[model samples]
Target: MKKNIYSLLKGKFLTSNGASQNWVMIFYLLTLAIVTIGSSHSADQKVHEIAKLNNEVKELRSIMIDGRGQLMKLKKESYLEKKMGEKGIAISEIPPHKIKVKSQKE
Candidate 1:
């Protein structure tokens, strides 16, 4: 056991005879490490994308609220009256009158 540990520490496992199994295990570990690193990078990219989308959603929501407030102000009766006054248009001061007609039958 001590000899095996010493050989492993001295990096002699790959150069010694009957080292084919050791080489296969090294390749498997390397493949696993590469896959782990790639997955971590992919996860990081997804997190960044989600954060960007969240920021965009917040900005769009604020813009929509601002537009809605402006629309509400423009649609108000007082605001419309003021704008029309600037165009020399005025509301009628007199009340409207209705007419009734009677029909005669022979």
Candidate 2:
């Protein structure tokens, strides 16, 4: 067992005649490690992309809300009257009265 340990520590197994299987196993482990690293990197990139999109969505939502608020302010009766007053257009002093007509073809 001491000899085996010493040989293993000295890396003799990699150079021995029966080390083809060990080489294959080493290459397989390396391939798996590389694939795992690539998958992890892909996942991390997707997570970053999702986070960036979320931030963009939040920004757009805030902008939309601000635009809606501005539109509401512009559409208010008081605001319209103020702007129209600046343009020399005054509101009529008389309140509107509805007129009803009776049909003769009853």
Candidate 3:
């Protein structure tokens, strides 16, 4: 047991006659490590992409809210009256009368 441990510590197993198995295991572990690193990088990129999209969504939502606010202000009766007055269009002093049309039966 002690001789086996000494041989392992001294890197003798890599040079011995049965070292092909050790080399295969080393290659397998290296491949697994590379795959693990690649998967982690892909996950990190997706997380960053989600964060960027979230920020863009928030910005667009705020812009939409701001546009709605401006539209509401523009649609106000007071604002329309002022603009129309500036354009020399005066409001009617008389109340509007709705005429009801009766359909003729044949």
Worst 10 residues of 3 by lDDT: 97-106
lDDT of 3 by residue, 3-42 (tens): 9899889999899899999999999999999999999999
Worst 10 residues of 1 by lDDT: 97-106
Ranking by lDDT: 2, 3, 1
Looking at candidate 2, what is the lDDT of residue 11?
Answer: 92
Regions of candidate 2 where Cα sits further than 4 Å from its true position: 94-106
Give the winner by lDDT: 1 or 2.
2
True lDDT of residue 56, candidate 3: 100
Best by lDDT: 2
Per-residue lDDT value at 46 in model 1: 100
List TM-scores for all candidates, in order.
0.82, 0.82, 0.84
lDDT of 1 by residue, 1-106 (tens): 9998998899898888978999999999999999999999999999999999999999999999999999999999999999999999987799889887777862
CA lDDT, every model vs. true structure: 0.95, 0.98, 0.97
What tens-digit string does per-residue lDDT give for candidate 2 at 1-106? Answer: 9999999999999999999999999999999999999999999999999999999999999999999999999999999999999999989999999999989997
Clashes of each: 0, 0, 0
Number of the top TM-score candidate: 3
